[model samples]
Target: MIRRAMVLAAGRGTRLAPLTDTTPKPLLPVAGRPLLEHILEFLHAGGIREVVINLHHLGHAIEERLGDGRRFGLRIQYSWEDPILDTGGGIKRAEPLLGGEPFVVVNGDSLLELHLEDVVAFHRARGALATMVVRPDPEAARYGLIELDAEDRVRRVVGLPPGVEGTFRGFMFPGLHVFEPDIFGWMEPDAAYSVIRTTYVKLLAAGMSVYGFLTPARWVNIDTPRALAAADLTLRTAPFRF
Candidate 1:
């Protein structure tokens, strides 16, 4: 069972400048509550007992607000970054806390209505090295894209080839995944690596089963002010609650 998770909150929200100036993007309020709080609540409700959150820019504020996991009914651990190790490094740093088991990793800034239990079950069922929660979209080029085979195993990443076309319908990653402990073996030690650029792509090259779970639910990547505002508005009117 995937009972632990890691929230990647270490990035400097360069795009969301003015708002991120005072508060980190993860702490930014969405629907009256901080985005990270909603993620914690979701994990707690999903029966996850432990969570490790990595913080870098304006991290003290997050540490002050969420000192421990007890307040949210979960054990909260902080992976304090000194030089702002990127996504891959951050996850590598927290692997000790995550232990030798497969765990869930979510971007603390992005908000999505994830079926945590269902996704976990699916991850174990498929026996993938990593299972990405992705959605089919026409605007696939704007973001990192995943190409899945007939069995839904991620065959190749979309961007590496210069003139890649829609061989298979591409999907935008929702910033959430279930990863096995072996996934870290593909990463280089002490280097700034992205799960997509370095790890996931390597898994595909090694012929590992990397699946994509297409979610029909709503997902928003809150990077810019306009996107954040739209997400807030959507969450308000949406029938489902995160």
Candidate 2:
């Protein structure tokens, strides 16, 4: 089972603007509590015992608020980035803490109601190099499309080459991924980059086993003021069970 995970919390959250000027995106309040707290609770409920959160952009406040993560039932560690690496770089930087095993990566700015055990199970069963939690969204093209074949294998990402002309479904990544340790082989060391735009695209080009797991779970990406308000209303009216 995948017990270790990384939370990409270092981004400046430029879209949120003035609100993020004083507070990190992950710490922004969604319902009654900080957004990161909800993410931690969800991770804990999903059976993640150890977590490594990459920090930058007023990161100390996050450290002071979360600390060892004991209250959240997690053993938390921090990876301090000098220039604030992007998603791929952040995970690569935290490799030492993640250990040599399959692990999960979550985008710190989004809220998802998923039973992670199911996602991990699907990943292991498919023997995929990586499995992304994708959801059908009408605005998927705006988020960069991830096209999945009938078998749920990711045939194309961001409209990269080797295009499929036949029937296929397009989905959007909801910031949840299960990856094997070997995925590091496809990434450069200490370079800032997006995993989707860089690593996943390369994996698809090389005919690697990248799969997409479609989920029915409700999700919200809290990046802009509009999104933040939507998330707050969603949680207040229909809170997640797990």
Candidate 3:
């Protein structure tokens, strides 16, 4: 079972600026609780006992609030990034802390209502190297879409995959994934790059088992102030499912 997870919390949250000027975006309040706290609570219920949260841009606030994570029933560890290492680099740096097994990775600012165990089970059953949690975004332009073949294998991500038939499938990546430790072999250590552009896209082109597990529930990406406000209102009404 995948009991370890990583939260990509190193971002500066420039999109949600000013408020993030004093607090890390993940630490921002959602329904009276910090977003990260809600995520941790969900992770705990999902059977994840250990978690790694990468920090930067007012990282101290997160460190101070979460502490060693005993209060949250988690063994929390921090990966401090001096000059915020983008998604790929952040995960690469935290490789040691994540151990040598497959693990879950979620964006700290995301609020997803889905079954984590099911996602892990799907990953194991398919023997997939990496699996992303995606949702149908018919307007594919803004978020870029990931297309899957009949076998549910990702045939294309944004652009076309090598030697594929006519038009490929497409869907939006919603900031959640199950990744095997071997997936890190595709990333560059200590360099800033996007996991999507650098790894997923490349792996798909090379015919790897990089697949997408579609979610039937709504996902909240708390990026802008308006988005955060909407998420806060939503969370107040509907309880998280994970």
Best by TM-score: 2
Model 2 score (lDDT): 0.90
**Residues forming the 10-long window of minimal summed lDDT in candidate 2:** 159-168
Tens-place lDDT per residue, model 1, 99-167, is: 688899999888677668888888889988899988877787688777776677776676643343345
Ranking by TM-score: 2, 3, 1
TM-score each candidate.
Answer: 0.93, 0.97, 0.95
lDDT leaderboard ranking: 2, 3, 1
- In candidate 1, position 40 carries an lDDT of 88
Worst 10 residues of 1 by lDDT: 158-167
RMSD of candidate 3 to the truth, in angstroms, is: 1.4
lDDT of 3 at 236: 91
lDDT of 1: 0.82
Q: Please list the residue runs of candidate 3 whose C-alpha ends up more than 4 Å from where it truly belongs after superposition.
A: 160-165
- Give all candidates' CA lDDT scores: 0.82, 0.90, 0.87
Which pairs clash (backbone N, Cα, C closer than 3 Å) in model 2? none
The TM-score, computed over Cα atoms with residue i paired to residue i, of candidate 1 is 0.93
